[model samples]
Target: MTTSFPDPAAFVGKVAFISGAASGIGAATAGRLARLGARLVLADRDAERLAAFAAQLATQDVLALNVDVTSMASVEQAIAAGIAHFGGLDLAVNSAGIDLPRCATAHYPAEDWDKVIAVNLTGVFNAVRNQIPAMLARGGGSIVNVSSIMGFRAFAGQPAYTAAKHGVIGLTKAAALDHAAQGVRINAVAPGFIETPLLAHLSEEKKQEAAMLHPVARLGQPDEITSVILFLLSDAASFVTGACYEVDGGYLAR
Candidate 1:
């Protein structure tokens, strides 16, 4: 069925909490939502970067906090601060994640495996666990967990990343089932390679090769993914939940 898009003002006066807000898709999403008039709580482990970015917004409606999503306590505190500051929460985006060194599953270092799962998988769990109550207290809310194309398919030498992303989709579905009837909608966005700071380390040739992997023959821009995320969080997607939206450049289709 066709659906009308939500008005730009749909999120006006709403409160949104975003993790990994210091850079990449998280930062882009925050800016877009803020422009739509949402009061924002931005969190990231990079305290300096988080504060600097939040300073650019420079409004009382914004709260910047250092949040280590791998730690339940850290996530809890950050959410609590947001709720206390804004008095309620209507939306959340769990975007804190890391990419570990590439290696075959058998050759992957156990330490890298632990760190990836901790940040990507467990981090989403912590956010969702803390966010649900805050959202419920506000009567209802929406959550978007950032997964990856690797979540559904696999790439050689990325066992840790693939496994963690796959777990995020599973977590998103399970959470949606548990909370859908209660008014909270949970879903995941599985993005293909996007041009973000995370890709800065790649060599020019490697970047080109990566881009060519997509049928669209280019990398996705951060704002492109942000648009999809904002739609899902907005009422325009009121019927969408427990699903994964791929914002790839048709990479998965190939």
Candidate 2:
């Protein structure tokens, strides 16, 4: 049998910027986008892991930058490096985020809340702040922000995570609207209970419980979310904007 699907590697001349590229969905998406022919600017605070991943990619032009997304100066420098390496950005994915361990609202430390907001919400803003101008310079581009299913549903003991994710949705929609006229398209992916390093800390019983929350009865893989992200960043989805594609295995439906 033969396949007629468009070759994923059609992005040969394009450039993409990805935050949180050190692990999980961010790493998976970076690999996927590279396989699809996009040159990459990979960013994360973990210098060791980031370099290791960059070295493994098939894309040789990969530029690895250690970025603390919470810091505006760090973000600006990363963007400068990206433009220097790839010329200009064609796509950007804001996947740098963190979640506090399950804790009751009353006991949720202000510090933890601040950390989550800084990395998950403000981090995304910092990505957009830097990449938008480069995309605009070239006429237009695409952006994918990683939100969470928790943004749309209530889960006990995750006040900070939920609030930060909700803010991501608002930001995605606002960016989509503001830049659509300028040929830029922005969207988000809201994933649920994926099997990633972030979730590896949970006990077997807790992991099973989390998996059962989704209608599919299994946790999602990072590739599952990456596939959708690649599509949104591709020309195939030029008409789609201000949308949040849920890769939650029907978790939101249950």
Candidate 3:
């Protein structure tokens, strides 16, 4: 259970349950945690991709579960699977979310708003509610929710997305307060524009425009967010809770 330089994050015997882990930030976080010696329980809706990812990391104590974060039943099933596979759950990353309907509040459709909220806000809630009990029973753990800069700031045409992200921060703080005393730390990461498969839907021009919006003059990578997440999940952040770490390349500053 030891590494060369004393991995403060020696999660070798620990279990990390991650939602939205089939790709993007979730996938990267899973890989990072695995490298740090954490047994992983990765959940996502994409069964095919999930299987492939699980296959690749199976040797590292990874179990893949197909889950729809919007569903309490699905979330619970995944949590149960994690406990069964890894014996108990020690940490969780609520990265399962969705984004669509890029329009102003006035033009945003009710259905689109509902869908976004269900997947982004409700999705995170389900993950947390399902995972916390196990973490509590184990005496201590960490929870990291993947929020976005829009959670605090605003873009021109993303009302539903912004609302859901803001809700995530509020939820994170409330949970942190509720569980910090129980040895469970809850926090959120608000990332700025990041280049991921999600951004692949945008045209070349749109992608560049989004990148330029960051003060860093470029978008973030999935790995960049992974670093912050790993730190928060590790013992290094034992004193940190209810905090919203901004991995936005100073986007909020501008």
**Model 1 lDDT per residue over 172-231, tens place:** 999999999988999999999999888998999999999998999999998999998988
Model 2 Cα RMSD, Å? 2.7
Looking at model 1, residue 102 earns an lDDT score of: 84
TM-score of each: 0.97, 0.96, 0.95
Residue 29, candidate 2: C-alpha displacement in angstroms = 0.8
Candidate 3, lDDT over the whole model:
0.88
1-254 per-residue lDDT for model 2 (tens digits): 33323455547778989999999999999998778788899999999999999999987879999999999999999999999877898999999988768899999999999999999999999999888888999899999999999779868998999999999999999989999999999999999999988897899999999999989999999999998897888778878899999999998875
Model 3 regions lying over 4 Å from their true place? 1-9
How much does each candidate deviate from the true structure in C-alpha RMSD?
1.5, 2.7, 2.5
TM-score comparison, 1 vs 3, better candidate: 1
Count clashing residue pairs per candidate: 0, 0, 0
Q: List the residue pairs that clash in candidate 1.
A: none
Name the best candidate (by TM-score): 1
